[model samples]
Target: MKKYIFLIILMGFTTMGLAQNSVSGTIKNRNNETISNVEISVSDAVIQTKSNEKGQFEIKNLPIGKWILIFKKDKFEIKSEQVSIGNQEQKILDIILENEEHHIDEILVSSVFNKTQNENVVKIDHINLKQIQNAGAINLSDALATNPGVSVVSTGVSIGKPVIRGLSGNRVLTYAQGIRLENQQFGEEHGLGLNANGQESVEIIKGPASLLYGSDAMGGVLYFNPEKYAANNKTELAVNQVVNSNTQGSNSSVTVKASEEKFKFLVQNNYTTHADYKTPNGETVVNTRFIEKDFKIGTSFATSRYVADFRYNYNDLNLGLPEEEIEDSRFRTPLFPSQKIENHLLSFNQKVFFKNSKLEATAGYVFNDRKELESIDEIALFMKLKTFNYNVRYYLPDFGKFETIIGFQGMNQENRNFGEERLIPNAKIADIGFFGTSQYKFNKNLLQFGVRYDFRNVTIQEFGEFGTEGSFQKLDKNFESINASFGFKTEITEKITTRINVATGFRAPNLSELSSNGVHEGSNRYEIGNPNLKNEQNFQVDLNVDYNAEHFDFFANGFYNNINNYIFISPNGNTIDDNFVYDYLQNNAVLFGGETGIHLHLHEIDWLHMTSSYEIVIGQLNNNSSLPLLPANQWKNNFRANFDVSKNIKNSFIFLQANYTFNQNNISQFETKTNDYLLLSSGIGTDIQMNKSKFNLYLTATNLLNKEYVAHLSRLKADGIYNMGRNIVLGVNFDL
Candidate 1:
């Protein structure tokens, strides 16, 4: 590890060279008239400038390479263009903006090449902070469910996990602040444990991304981009508040930031408290309340040749377990059978710029403490996890029309338990990987490909027997794998584009799946691990087509995945201390799915918009049996109108939405079918100007029709409990 660290630093220093690049642009309207006061920003760089009265803007001291420029202004659609800069060369660009009547395309930062939405080889979804706030989501998982090809598997409202393409748990990877999150995610009841208040935007990769992020990315990746610092020589402050009726919950947050020419800093704090959520029948689920507190701080320093950033985040959660009956109280304090989780994370990122290339490095450390209580004053289980990760990437000099990247990533983790009940024994894990990827563009067609190799080692400590359960013996395992991918994107016609990709991914068995020999408290079952389990491998193919016209947009995405040695738990027709006995097993499986959507805007009534989307997925074992916890087919439709109530009340809009979930009869033998249901919801939002401050106000209603329904993926469904319903939310945000 020390040698690797030294090598990375040496490479950064050796690649240093001197170069000066500048970009100048003129912004105009559809009528070819120069427009002023447009905000222009360069991607992955700390340069932002506004257009002068002559509609001209210039950014200097930039790296000599390809860059994406974004132009934005009020009442105008956003525009992005790709530009390349040579050493000591001044590039000039002309940009045109249309009226804010059509949906604007966003640039995807998570892609290997930082391509635009229409140019990416794989489908990526973007959800901005503004949209998350408008939806009035209480957690990260709920906020992400608004996008197609995404769903939430929940033990309850406070314990929801993200499911993508019929895969959850360790199959999906979550990244925040450019670091992979590892908080004992092998359990079904483990939530994301991330706060959405301080995030700028969330990007979802819809398919396997093992080439970029080594393991645990077989399903996809959820990248949470932090909010950027204030513009140069500026200071800003903001506060937000939200209230929910169903849970009697309140969320409050505050943020402050300042930036100068060479340095910038930001800080944020958030607090949330809620009571038991109520169902459509006005029945309160016992022990369903939760409380959370979060704090984050970040700072950065930038020079002509180097940039360094440091960030720290702290989160504390008191989540209640909605299992057996307890007190039906509306207080914030959790009752018995609850959980307390505290997480601390620190990360440092560095970038060294050369004349034609750049080197990036990131190091992160995370500490997680989890405690579960079965009695009011006694702890049932306690586990502590500590992880250190490092990543280094070198961008090779631009090769004519090609871009190349070589990277190395590694992680070291330790897990220990100090409780009466041991779900998983003490374990240590280490991983290292090396990969290289490249992109080549010719005319309107782009080609992308990559390959990676990874090695992992795991060691477990033996533990004593518990009651009648067998003892767990010491184990050591080593795994190695190689994966690759190929993709292509092209514009089929002036108004249509298509992308095709094929990728292979793999995952090693988690400690819980290989070491556990007792009853799992979260799932209420006796799970016996398979000590000799092998690694799981998958291969997937994806196809996406998009059509963009003057007044409408349409998209279609399809995917098929095949897996070998897929591990799952099945009942063994036995019981241990009244809990059903389940054994970890492996089988070959196949999953196929697709999502389709369309957005329409009326040309005559520019303020009127309509959207409709449908998604379905099927997961089956080699024996023709359905997989467990598969999401049902769902369809969503929305109608919205935007208008100005008055000069002070600008950007006013109201929307009505409907969600239809079809009956899920395709299930495993241990699962039950869920009935079909339709849910109605609506919301209204507007901007209010008071003195020198602008405030955003929104009101949203969910499950407005009060339909009593249970989602097929809800963990509480087995207990005959319905999901939350008839929720009313009100929120206010403002900058100071």
Candidate 2:
């Protein structure tokens, strides 16, 4: 608590040291015609403004030093320029744009350098939240799964976990509001613990990213960008509502934002509730209901030499464990054997500008309280976790086509138990890492390389009576490793581009894997942990090729990852308390996969578009055995058309999609094979502008044929439970 107060005070002082600066600009097209409503944004800041009727725009409260400005508009090519803010009170500039037909690429801030996807050496996939909502996704994970090379592991419709390239659980990391999210992710049934409300977009890094995010990123990263504040000197309010047919669910949110030249503030409240979901055979799944309540508040302040942003979020969830088969009811309250989780997150980001360089620091604190109930008030299991993490980086001035950055990252976490049953011992974990990376540009080609060293310490406290069932002994462990990454991106020709990267990553054993000594609830398994497990390390190589033309585009991405000291669990042919016993083990593993897709626009019918993609992954151990919990291959196709109905109605569209999952015959020692299945869906949406208020309306129907199919990654697969059946969603949104 003292540390938090000290940091806040420091930021307050820094933000008041100097006066603010401003920038003004004018925008025009190649024909020398003014372009009104063009968006102008600062690359790394949350500040943005639109051009007025005269094609003039101004953004205030900028810090001193260098900044990148991006200009974007429909039917025009995007442009970027770098400018320096010195002693001038305000900088002025004029820009021109060219006509173009391709989609505008957004600036990617997740990378070291604030460059677009096409300009960065690393390959990243960026998806807008509006696009996901237009596709009628019920949750964030389901929306992300629509992208190639991504899948979901689900306990039910309400609980979905993200899986990237056959890696789930703790291997992948999630970031929100410019800080890492920590929410007891070692459990298989643990969900993402985040809502889609107030999110602008998501950027996915599909390979090892230890070079940037340190540990727990052996697989990849999912960075959620929050919705920006209203344009400078603007105040806005929005309301959204959605209803679902399958679960008898309703989702609603309200947001308000106010921005000034030097200060911005926002607040949002979201609520979601659902009853039991029904299958195609008119059978309702028992104890599958859930309710979530979320609240968020943020503020930003800037000066001539310093910028500070602070955000706070509170989330509460009442999730049901679908292990009971009792009578189906439409009650919003969850049944017994349920989970109640409450999470609180606070993030602070500060930037200090120098004459020739800059410094950035970010700090975050998270508190998670989790409880499981056997009855109305009887707590079966409970755990509370607290975490604090920080990152600091120094950006060196550009020198001879070179950009470099050096940083330090660290985290401190503590776990405690307060229930009758304990799954793991009370523990404390500490992590520290140091890294340096640089990017070199030459003739439209980019080369990037980096190295990092990390250390982790784990300390466990003895719990219960030692040498007995469900008892854990005290233990201490330390792990250290060095990792590195290299990448090169270049254009092979005017129409073709290629990117190749090689990176290494490492992960320290999680608490569940190192200290478990009891029967895990809901899984029906007795698990024994390995106290002397070695660190899991991996090296991966990624390749990407893209071809662009007037009427079509094609892209292919492939990767090969080899891991040493990979840890997994297998049955030990023993039973305890009428439950199968499993023992943790280690081995060398390999996973290889790729995604290929092509999109085409009809030349004669300008409004018609078609897209198809295929993704496959194969995971194997050193002994030539298949790995567990791997998703099957998939193929997806989409068709869409955009047209206008009237002058008041704009951007109207209709879409049809089909997805096929291949049969999974390769099974692990304790797994079963899954058959193939196909599903179809469709939707229609349009934007309407009334006299004063703007509105959006959409209707989406999933599982058009009411297919009865089970996915390979479903935890309920063992019980012969199928996925959700035909469902429809009606959504409406309006701005004031």
Best by lDDT: 2
TM of each candidate vs. truth: 0.95, 0.97
Scored by lDDT, model 1 comes in at: 0.85
- Give lDDT tens digits, candidate 2, residues 657-724: 99999999877888889999999999999989897578899999999999999899888899998888
Per-residue lDDT for 1-736 in model 1, tens only? Answer: 6535744663354343345567887899989999986988777765566788999887765666677888888778778888877677788888899887667465656778666676677778888866767866777898888888899998778988999989989899988888888899988876988888888899998778888888889889999888777766668888999999999999999999997756889999999998999989999888888999999999977655666788899999999998765866648788888999999988878778766788888888889999999887688889999988888889999899888999999889999998788888898999999999998989989899999999999999887854346457789999888999999989999888999999999989999889778888777889899889988899999999989887899999999999889999999999878999999999999999989999998799888889999999999999999998898999999899888899789889899999899999999988999999999989999988776678899999998899999999898999999999899999999877
Error of 1 at 614 (Å): 0.4
Best by TM-score: 2
In model 2, state the lDDT of residue 677: 95
Q: Could you tell me the TM-score of candidate 1?
A: 0.95
The local distance difference test score of each candidate is: 0.85, 0.87
